[model samples]
Target: MLTLWCPSAASMESAKHAPVSPVLPSYEQEQHLHAFHACEQRHEAMARLLVVVWDEPGRCDLRAMTHVVTAHLRRHDTYHSWFEERGGAIVRHVLTDPTVIQMEPRTLGEVRAEDWQRHVMATPHPFAWDCFRFGILQHDRGFTCFASIDHLHADATVIAFLMAEIRSAYRAVLDGEGPLQLGPPGSYLDYCASQRQRAAAMTLADPEVKRWIAFLHRNGGRMPSFALPLGVLEDRYHAEYVHLDILDDAVMDAFESACHAAGARAIGGLLACAALTERGLAGRSRYSVVTPTTTRRSPKAFRTTGWCVGVVPIDFDVQQRAFPELALTAQRNFDERLSLAEVPIELVLELAAGLPTVGSVATGGVMLSFMDVNVPPLSAHIAREWHQANGRVYINQGIAAQVAIWLFRTPRGLSLTAAYPANETARASMHRYVKAFAGACRQAAEALMPTYSDAGREQ
Candidate 1:
């Protein structure tokens, strides 16, 4: 059974009286809401995961953590209204008493292998309507936390930002400072209204529509599906974050050199690797990669804080060309899609629905996957600080599919995280997949560099 940690009467009353404020509509927020509404129309739900990390025994402080979270909530105008609008969707409750647990901690690896499993299995979801719940678990050494956020509210990027903010607030409390104040901007509801107005004004040009129609007709008008390999299903879902260091010098020289030589951009190089991986694993020649775009294209929609984000579908052909050529092709398609990004993903999904569904052989009974690349304004310094302070961070953990590859550019290089169900394949296989992906990226870069002749002249 699920649990409802109802606020006290006074707390409830205070929440009711909380001032409503405006917020800016971020491109991400609007697109997310559009997708949510689209999925809701089909009676489907969005599921996400949040992982939190805590300090070793001497460092763990549940009371301090809670205080920080509450204070963070109080100071941020966006959160105040966000919670208020949802009738305070966020909850605070203890699973196990902190007084009984020691603050001194242990290593994260050991804690993850033991304490995390025990707590999650024992605790129920916190809210009845909550797509997921969060838990704070104490271990003999350190602590770890988990949350399953519903997809309707926001995507992973927003959740990550919120967790970082919570950690910062907690640290501030520890330092005897007040919580961080987030000024008012706009509301999500307003963003939705704005989206409708903008969408109405725009119509696909006959030529553009014809292009899409022609592409669909040529390709049999069906989207390909990605099936998770059956071998991986036995392992529980696990998340790991890995970084691909592209130093500033490398970024300016090697990265750009590789991209330009391949006729691809930074993002294109990454997508090309994804496309290659899909072909290698599934033995499919054609596939689609879903990339997200912020919906803050309209100045009016800026500052509105609802779920304004959309996913653009870029189809790639793996069969006809070399990986480098495919990379450039993917890049061209990606750029074209970006130009038309203002169209909400919901509308695109709706458009796709109009076409006939042509089923393909399922390598593992899954189809339709996405590779999300988020380069938001949030920095790694903040992410690391939050993870060190809190046991976990909230990220958009989309539903389990063949795989979801998340690449975030950091000061060190590129941070690559892959979330897949353990039951789907062996650890060795997954590891190989990651390696292949990395190798492909390197090869694509190398292919993009200018070749020199024996005379030392550029070819």
Candidate 2:
């Protein structure tokens, strides 16, 4: 639940008559194109992949489902937009027609859901058309609902917002309530226009730009990469996904307590563990990785469904430091870096010219993403419903040379999902990494439990 505002179909109908306009792409969108073209050179699809899977009790009515999905597509402007070249520049062309909503219906005869999902995920989206594919796979008792949207258009938060909308709309239609009267959705195009203005106002002397330059200089003019060997010499389209239940509620509670006692957010504990694990695995004293931060700076941006995310570089030493101390330090480092999260990576790269570009961008380097469903938007009350529905998100790691880890907390517990190159060497490395990470999590919680308990008693 990244946003509370849900747009209705009628709210966007007025835009159907507006003239088509070309908008400048955001930094994230530009990075996506860079990756996309790199993949094309290798005969692969660049994955801005997002997939959500859930189950419904009985066979869903295709016609009714169609109406609900159409409403969703019309609610968001990105769903009706695509990238195009206009006079030597890449721009997003937003369509004003409300009639064009992309939904590819498919029935699973005997094909596995995972296989079908991966197949659909690997195919490149038509650049001139809507980059969304929604389908239903019917089986005996029920059907699985699958939705995939290109990351260029929607991030995880946007996907969550969309899924919730669909669920509510579908349920209403089934119960004869029809469409809910959701508020008008915010336009991502407007956000992009503001970002362009922000970028225009920035200079090489800006403190944020200087900070980014220093960060890149520390890592040899590029973003830091995974400390350990991934055995990936080049980009490969195939990737393996792993999901593990890292911690149950009790342990997660302890972990949170420990983090709080050590003056750090719960995410700090995970970052500390990541640093230690990399050190132990590769003897690299410093842990460096790129992380995504939400750039929903204003209320309108928060309500808008688009890639409102920015990348930040984090680096810290993990040598001979205890979990709690390291966690605090990691938190401090994260806080300092987050202040500049709004600075576009494209600008950073431009200011720090002549820098080696290999393994520098977030897509080419190591990345860590964490989502706490217990927090706002995706709070436990809503998370409980999603868990009961067996809702899951998937990422297609097409043409990636690095590992990206996603950690999420649901009502059930803390879980880890990772995507890496789908080769034996990389798989083995990721497995080892996950194992070490899990152990680190428990160790951090156990090590700080006594102090946490004592503090609680004093209070």
Candidate 3:
């Protein structure tokens, strides 16, 4: 069992007026609003993964960690608005249990495979007005903390980045450095304001926008939903971490070669891997992956922090072409989507008022599967350290029960994980799917290597 301590009224009051600007809503927010409205109409729970990574100091100090986290909240507007926008509630909690903390292992592989499954199932949703709960686990080498956040509030990228920053702050405090001054906190409201200005200023749609609109028109304005195997409903969600080594020299060589040979960016390579994985799993061609693209294509958005992201579909037909060819296709699609990502999906839906809604598509028998490939700015050492971290590093959270795949890249290689509901497929089937996906990745990499080398020589 874990115990939680509520913050003092005085503390809450003082934290309320922290200096922060309001961010305008981006096109993404408009889409989310539409989705939320739809979900409200259907009364179905919106699922998301809430993850927490704690440092391995081997001690349990719920209050201390909370205090450290709270202090930073004072300086960051994003932190403040996050809690405020959610009805003046922060869905977060702190757990103080030495036994729980002691159970986590020090190394990534040593972490119990069942830990993730148990954590997700047993974890309770924070009350509509309460902050998220944080569970502390003790391992032989250090302590681990767990949190299951609601996806409706924030996606994994933001959550992961926030967690990493918090950990960095906590570690700095532990080292006797006063909390690092993270510059003036950017407000989400400000971002929203900027978005409004951009939208207002735009008169003509770009070519990419035209292409997307045409695609939407061809598809009849229905968004596809991924199908989950029925087996997922029976078994609990469990997580496993797999590590692959890509030495510094190898990573640099691979990065340069892939970029030059394919005329694609590093992220393109990651997407190509995802396409290969999907090809291996479905064992067919003509599949589409919906991925999130940051709307911060403009220089102004570079420094601004807000939820300015929208989903775009990348369609691939593996049977019709080779992996390299597919990689090029994926790259082209990604580039085009990024250019027009500023347009909100909600706006598109609104513009096509007579088109069928997502619900209607579900009723009409269209299955949608997606791959979210997150390639964070990777430095060689940081990638190595993540691989070295203890506990299972999972790429997928089986929240939708659909075949959702997540890819995280490091200097060594890519770490790919897929999550499916246990009730949806047999264990053998799931394993086979994973194996096939891995093989596709290897084939894609091998086929691209020579092309990359030849391009490098030409250069």
Candidate 4:
């Protein structure tokens, strides 16, 4: 099992003193600008990815760990980059000078990782520079590495990449080999420039832009909200987090087989299950959601530590449909929607001025993210080297009206993590929803049992 850790006073102080030397030529991307403005407008804890790296007992040398972190900060462009508002627009700022964040590992003491996570998340990091926080916690049996980076700078994929690099670096340093000579990660700023160029060449008449406009139009020209009622009226309140082990390996294996038999992938099967649960709980026949997708199309960005992600709206009717049928439709819908996944909703809003909105509809809507961690960089080192049982992503722990669910498929099993508004009614509602979701998933797996059984008999 992975453990948690908190930062010492010295480490926090180091973050404060980290210097940033700004270089010229600023660039902007829709997603980054939207995240920056949202951070500017909200005082609450924003979404961040919290990662914990496990190590042998008492073997977590502070000196070696500091070297590892300093080396990572130097290699990733995002770590050396920040944002600033200039003449009413948020622009990127890069630090050319040496950027080093000291790592001082203190004992775990009495502080729980959850509480410390909230405290660190609540404590704002500087957007001008050093927007990420890192720490180490030493325990009797072992030590763990802890770090948090907001949505503006990092996502789950980026976190996975960085953690693998850190593990490799830390191991090397421990063996007295020092930092590895891995080349710099692909520049996120260059990716942003490409995004701007692609967006610039398009107009309102472009099919992708029109498709987004239609999606918004279908949802009252705003982002889709949670169909279930949230009892709170306040804008900000305490948030509740729920982790559900939805399926064991055996059941998940059967479910994946069922999905294959039905001509759908496991992701599609899972989406069908979620849609069924939504319909059962809220009596809604239509399931609509904004799912996040990565934009790292270039192989060079396979290790880039940037927020190169986009949100795609997926919706389908789930009325009187069987599990396999719904799963197939969901898969097709999800696959077909990727053509416009790279198109930013902010750009869509900009080009289509006639679209109605009370305020920014770019965020604060129901979102679902799914990832099979067995892919590429994550699979290469996650379980073997990192063993990160506690390395999870945290989003919108502050006030929120909608629920955001992250589904991660690991070697162990498929698990669901959700964040929702904290209220008695919301809490009860989410638990029921989770239960329904799990039930639907199991039933889907069971439904395919007969087909497999018949095949076995025929053989």
Candidate 5:
């Protein structure tokens, strides 16, 4: 089984000597997964939320939707599992409660979209017993569902699956005149168990994972220079973030085509953009970006909410290449790293002993994530609008990092959210950086031919 990276030496020894973990072998979990682990280790709630409004009154069985969703939740231990910080390593305790899944009813027109954002900020989602919540807001127009989820339990992909499952369950409810029978869920624990077995096969002594650890070890880890000076002073519990709507439909389509043309994934392309931006402003040519990817290898795993995310750090040395060339290189690197993305962060932590406890040191420098909400298009839902706020930290965890760039692709195109420390100077710098990022991407998309693009490339 893959060893859990314990924050304490005592826990490490316990994991080594103990015959069987409190939970299953996989129950030890991927608590060692880069920044993904922090959701469990830290005291903060680390709550993430989602707001969905289904305007269409077409055969929408609210009760059935809730029923099937709750049924689905019961299937995955990861969602129901409450992780407690025991001794040193985290222990997963899975408990099922019917009260936890009820989607409460709320007065619809009363709650604005921004209100949901403020609500999550003002009242942090506690990581105590129940880690997930659902509420239905009733309005004059349509019905909206608000979900407050603990990041400790689910990452982006898991969250996506949760939303998709709800929609699918609603469909199933509609399909079966009354009874919504969701055939048995392929056990998520089994997946984790398999991962543990695979991890055992690929021991820490495996040269590939070890090489990465040693390579990052030399640079004193992936800690980047924290955000520029500006914004809220009290880092913790106060969110300092900016959201940008970068592309409309036409441009977004071209951007995707450009990604295909340039042979780059969305995350890699963004990394290339950020890298080129940094090269000009900071005179730094290369950037190491920690990209979080979901390891949804099976269709069954994709159907449930669970933590199978990995931090795939891509080193972007695109100083000499044109945007298209950078894209091709980034795509190649993304694929290679993803193929071996299972390398445990615990191993890296064990090797880099004294490194500063900062935000995701294993793949630090900057975290760039691209999420295309993997659900049926929003048009399918009956709702006037939809709102989402992902990874908005109320209190800064005091990780010395340059910035975290999150890219979300909606039907409207790209929504870029940048989170950094609260500093006036840093805010100004972030503005410039974002402007540069947008400009770089636009130019890159137009200049698909590296041969011609290199001439106009930003030096």
Candidate 6:
């Protein structure tokens, strides 16, 4: 049976007083602590957006959020990757005194959506090592918990887990429930321990390890000639933000169903569309792309999050593959690499750190991520403007790749967002590419339906 770390009711009740262990950096992180510092130096503004919505304005309490966040930080030390400025290194230290900023409530119409996104992207977390900041965005109707974090220490999963914990603590406080305790716990420290154990048990000569090295080489190979060459690294402007694009529930659900019929995940159909869109620009069916995946296993791992993400590099030739076939091909590529998910990316880069490879960020300028999660501890009684909108918030610092594409499933459905350097790629061209991506996804999904399958069989 699969192991899960869920706590029973009694254990949960007693967990409030449970003592937590001291936090430390993961084994992989300890090995590359200096690299994390270097990354911080390169991108001074590395924070991403995190917004929490609440329904009842009067009932919303910033104090509750503060108590929960501070307490939660102590419970999970991975949340704190404080960079020691004096020593010029990263160290884990749960801040006993974390600054919680509170702002008066404002109206959602205070700024346009694009401007809001731009503002968030430009604002980095004040303390470089601490990673995240907490504040209250007071609105006329309700309040939003506005948080920002350093990408160096956390991923979306980390962000999700943190939010969930904070929400739980906040609820407990509001209900006079007491300090929320985590039961049947699996912390980031545990993840680090597991990774070190796994790494120790394996060797580079192992088939899977060799496959990863080769995969890195494939990504490190020559970059594809895009319809438009991505902006050079030295250019004054690297990338510009494009308006968010969305696919509502009906379209997203239909697309998902289509993918299922073809024995593929939504990602397969997405990759198929992306390749076709590239074909529009390059007039070539051969292409390579990168997809980021989480390595967390079991409910315990999900209970606590950290920088536990890995990437899969895929190369495909769509020159003769039809939409459904291309989708399946993409699915197969992802499945093959799933076995290597547990291998730390740092290990792969260490093996081929400076070697020439297409996977080099400069050579391959495209990156993609897919997310569909609800902020578990977050729900407002009242529906606000953000609630009505079907779009997902997206921000990229151009640290990973020059062109970034993200698809997220919101309450309404799936939303697609794209970004590219304004200097190299025209806004007009980016718009066309985004639409083409949407169109390709729709066409592929339709082609995968059983009716389409029957028609092909009849032929």
Local accuracy of candidate 5 as per-residue lDDT tens digits, 1-459: 000110123322332332323444242244422233464466443324432223223433555655665565556656544444555555555443423433322223355656655554432333343445454545455444445554545555554445545655666677775554445455565667776676656655777666566446434554343323444343333236788776654565566677777777666677777778877677776665667777767666665555666667567575677777887888888887785557656545654465463224333245778887524322313111233312122222333324677887765667788776556676788888888888777766665433434443332
Best by TM-score: 2
- Flag regions of model 6 displaced more than 4 Å: 1-44, 47-56, 84-129, 158-161, 180-185, 200-203, 219-227, 233-237, 353-364, 374-401, 424-429, 446-459
Per-prediction TM-score, please? 0.59, 0.86, 0.65, 0.84, 0.73, 0.73
User: lDDT of each structure?
Assistant: 0.46, 0.72, 0.46, 0.68, 0.54, 0.56
Worst lDDT run of 10 residues, candidate 2, spans 1-10
lDDT for each residue of candidate 6 in 199-297, tens digit (9 for 90 to 100)? 767766777767776765654443333355554553223456654545655566778777777778888878877888888766866767767777776
Worst 10 residues of 1 by lDDT: 94-103
Rank candidates by lDDT, best first.
Answer: 2, 4, 6, 5, 1, 3
Query: Which candidate, 4 or 5, would have the higher TM-score against the true structure?
Result: 4
Q: Please, what are the lDDT tens digits per residue for candidate 3 over residues 92-159?
A: 22121111111111222333547645644444332222233344555666666555444333444454
> 1-459 in candidate 2: lDDT tens per residue?
000112234433433434456578887777776667667767875556687878777877876787787778777776666676556456665666666543434444566647675655644463535456676676787877777777877887655556677877898898999678656777887778888888888877899988888777777666666665677765343677889888877678888888998899987888999998988888888888877878776545555678888877788888899888888998898888896778887867765565553224433567898888776655566577688878888776656655789898777778898888777887888888988888788777776565435333210
- Residue 176 CA displacement from its true place in model 2, Å: 2.7
Please provide, for model 1 over 346-390, each residue's C-alpha lDDT reduced to its tens digit, 9 standing for 90 to 100: 344344454554222111222222222223334555555444554
**Model 4 misplaced stretches (Cα beyond 4 Å):** 1-43, 48-53, 98-119, 122-126, 181-184, 233-238, 356-360, 384-396, 450-459
Clashes of each: 64, 0, 46, 0, 20, 14
Query: In candidate 2, residue 37 scores what lDDT?
Result: 64
Q: Report the Cα lDDT for candidate 2.
A: 0.72
Candidate RMSDs in order: 9.5, 5.9, 8.7, 5.2, 9.0, 9.1
Model 2 lDDT at residue 50: 82
